[model samples]
Target: MTQTLLPATSTESSSRPVVAVTGADGFIGSHLTEELVHAGYRVRAMAIYTSQGSYGWLDHVAPEVMQHVEVQLGDVRDAGSVRALMRGAQTVYHLAALIAIPYSYVAPRSYVETNITGTLNVLEAARDLGTARVVHTSTSEVYGTARTVPIHESHPLQGQSPYSATKIGADKLAESYFLSFGLPVVTLRPFNTYGPRQSARAVIPTIISQVAAGQRVIRLGDLRPTRDFNFVADTARAFRAVGEAGPEVLGRTLNAGSGREITVGDTVKLIGQVMGADLRVEQEDIRLRPEGSEVMRLLADHSELQALTGWAPQLTLEEGLRRTATWFTDPANLARYRVGEYTI
Candidate 1:
């Protein structure tokens, strides 16, 4: 069943609870790692093993933040590695998965191996190790096309693409673990999280990077589709909120979003406004999702999260876009992106 671990806050290093995070080297994972460290938790971050010894985005975090983080090179797909990562952790924030929607179409098997199997490894390890809590990451894509406006956690899951399908599988596994074994788990479904350090695979970064690279004509897909974008910082805070909240959130799934919706076309216009650019649009067939696979709408109803954890979106779309644009416009940061190339 459930085991209660040490309290989240403590002044002494010996008293600080250890938290493990999978996929801590990627976009949201890296941000969440920094967030946990700032919240005074000792973080054991699992970065995918690579010969180059790259920690992905974790290498870019401030040295002060890195001081509190222990980067462990491992793969979530391997149960042994996942177990080692969670050995003594009080809580595990599982964010590792194959996240690129377009690539999932070409390599669906890889998504299953990494996303579905990887999640199983985390759940099994957490269950066996008696970890106090598991914060499993979910995405808005799982609630494809939003059968109703302001999608809630109860929205029917529609796997519009291979990536979403695998995430749905992972989410269900997490649910099964909580129900079958009373393993404490909370699934956090975030809608369109975007900000600095986000890769070009996401829409917000795609538009911002193109504009930052001086492209007057922005190439995008399905301008009609609308999304409820949440800033990365807000998303990171939501993870912490649920991770640290009392047992009321156990065995629950919560939505985190701005509760505001904007069409891709309008989003581009807004980013243009934020960057002080006069932009034009060029729809690209290659960039578009397959006809039936596209998720045309997603708007989040995060009221449940607010009621449970007092968490709410703090940055407006414009303010968030401004901050994202500022970071992308910086030459050093902008150089990291291949602006003209389609990343999918």
Candidate 2:
């Protein structure tokens, strides 16, 4: 299913430290893999092992870029598979996890297993292999509905959803390893990341695909809830920046975001504006999260990242949406998505 999903090879890396990404088949992971290759590192794009041998978004990238990296099929849950992939891999990027919030409610245990266990496996492998850098992926959901505006790393975490809870567990596990064993690791907490190749299960893709596909009534859950949207390209750069930040900032968590907030209602309007229409949002009852489970708002504090590494967001929400809308509007691309349906 990931065929034409992620780009799959490398051309310009030799003798540089290899950066292995566990979920290279995923949206953010695939983009980050590409950026790592462009940054002149030997990149090992490891997708979960499956019989079909699908490469996901890696396949969407031009073959010329594809020639610049190595693709490895493996699963994060399988420790041996993960360890073997970690060999000679100087840096490890662990983005392999089931992240759908709604699905987590139905199968909370799977979230705990995959998100928590998989992370433990990554830490263990990185520890033994002595991986020089480990940049763990953390989501803004871990902060739940923020109790304060522009939530920072010191902000308290609340597991408003099972998905958030599991991620919190995984993050805590990462922190423990860093503190106890001194693993050269940094955690990046990215706010709402939106871009091409994102699954429809996410709000941005769900809304953009539907609107771009000419849907008059764009279905959505809560419009009042706001999020700090970060373009995927910028978020990918954050991963590289975290790794290059080194030990002084080691064991620290940085927020990769635009530091700007937009309500879902306003975001829908923005998408409509990009699509050249003022589409109406219809509340899809089924699309709504459980009353108490939904995160009402999320605004990120990105100051630490800038002060620490001089890394800042480059794309505005409007620019990112225009690009994302353009991609989803392409017939060849739109056909890749089930735009007309409510994606659970």
Candidate 3:
């Protein structure tokens, strides 16, 4: 009953093992799906099912790329659904979760259900299906306010917020599967990934949308905090690299980022420069994370990832911002977001 779009070459045998993506409708997931398709892989894209038939960002992917993708609808939290979606796939990229930090504060249980339980479902399904590889997505937020200048995979994980707490739990679950069941899983902990098609809940999209709407003041929080951001394309490529890496990387967590840190305030100024507009920033109470929950700095030490796969981020912060600003300024793309509102 599932539909797979294949190119003419696949009409002969279609022997390429299918790769399933669990959050294929999301920002990073959608990009990764497209990347996988472009790389000659048959992709089974699992968009979260909704009655309205919306495929999230997948609806915006170019039709040519869609030819190699099979868009399946399912929820990751449901083990049966996950197993069904991954039945014929050789690899799975588990990226489905409730990722908003503020929303986690409001609905901690939802974060637990989606992030923790959802990961468990993927692990169980992968193990049961004898999948060749699994790439579990992790966040830089798990390393709360860096204890070291450039955080490494060895850094102690701190759960400063509910979202990070659940993600930590999910990461531990992935590790448990690798140890207990010998599931071939690689955990990819990516720092802030920003670019077009990112939802308004994230900082980069929110700031770009607000500025593109001609707002005089940009509402932001904790300008002193810094982050290491990777462009979406680079991040997607990193996922593929991790997925295809040799057995040496099994059960290991790799960090993917630009290895460059920039403050939130400076990012605003940089976006202003990209947009060719003078920007003023205002701190909003609603935008601020709880005092102890704030992660003041995150700089990735992706030496392990680089050594393993020869992967490095391709775009500088300014270049990525320029492209993001251009996309957000387009009337068609701009219409998708409510620029005046705080999404969280």
Candidate 4:
């Protein structure tokens, strides 16, 4: 049986065309959803279905921001659900996925289904539904480690972990749809994205949450690895830019990043600097990725995206980290995380 989810609000009342976003309840997804709404676009925000009536990160979205949004409930893994969520949408930003690398190692099949098969469902639905545009989210992890200093779109894809492997498959599937079926899909590969509402599982959040909870020693793993981090707001803007870009971007993959890199150790120290804390570090084995699975470095060459959409990263790493740390300082927000626990 097909579940037909109509927009909860009437777009006919406004000139804005309705856009749908899968994973609209997660970190970057929620940020994108709110940004879309603020940008005066009508948004059909699809949160994963739950019996408890929760909307994940969206549950915390300001009531004013959600007024322009039509909240739909569905799973991206279900073809029927994906199709229903996408029908009548002019543009779709598909960000839903099982994203934890460590978790991917534990349950590879789940990653395959949710990331690969789920992406296939979106592409097929977009093709069938005649969706005007589809911005399929990709990640820097697909490049594994930096084979080159500044990785370009042409960089060879290496699946260093189950998470990245499935994403690679998903990206190829998106590319196939464009070549084979003429789906207007653009892949936006964002580097490490960090900001408010990011979960404890992420490194930035892990460091900050511990500090916010008054821990003097930060526990971490693989401090040698570096990442090209982008703030969630900047990443969200990049999505809109690609979604609104002309057909020149069709079937192309663009990188969304700061074009700068920082090692984990330096990043931790920066966070402490922003928080005015004198910090000690403890490297925990449990927090470490398997030797071969670790991605040692990532620096994005985002020139293509800038040349195409005139989009450049707005917030510096220090500024973004400061904002994120400030948010985590709220007792309510800080309480949501398990400060000292190592999240797999």
| Each prediction's RMSD to truth | 4.6, 3.4, 3.3, 4.7
Per-residue lDDT tens digits of candidate 2, residues 1-344? 12232443333345656888888889999889878877777778887766777888887866645666688888788898889878898889889999989888789998888899999999998998889988899999999888998898999999999899999999999999999999888999999898999999998999988887778798888899999999999999898888888577788889988989999999988888878987988887888888888899899899999888889999989999999998898899989888768664
Q: Which ten residues in a row have the lowest lDDT in candidate 2?
A: 1-10
Per-residue alpha-carbon lDDT of candidate 1 for residues 5-34, written as tens digits (9 for 90 to 100): 343333554466899999999999998988
Weakest ten-residue segment in model 1 by summed lDDT: 1-10
Which prediction has more favorable lDDT, 1 or 3?
1
Clash-forming residue pairs, model 3: none
The CA-based lDDT of model 1 is what? 0.92
Estimate, for each residue in 51-89, the C-alpha lDDT of model 3 and write its tens digit. Answer: 999999999988767767788888998888899889989
What TM-score against the true fold does each predicted structure earn? Answer: 0.96, 0.95, 0.96, 0.96
Write the residue-wise lDDT of candidate 4 on 1-344 in tens digits: 11223343554426677899999999999999978877778889889878899999999987767767778898898999999889999999999999999999899999999999999999989988899999999999999988887999999999999999999999999999999988899999999999999988999999999999999899988899999999999999999999999999999999999989899999988988999999999999999999999999999999999999999999999899988988999999988888889787
Ten-residue stretch with the least lDDT total in model 4: 1-10
**Two-way lDDT contest, 2 vs 4, winner:** 4
How far out, in Å, is residue 151 in model 2? 0.5
Any runs in candidate 1 off by more than 4 Å, and if so which?
Answer: 1-15
RMSD of 2: 3.4
List of clashing residue pairs for candidate 4: none
**Segments of candidate 4 deviating more than 4 angstroms:** 1-15
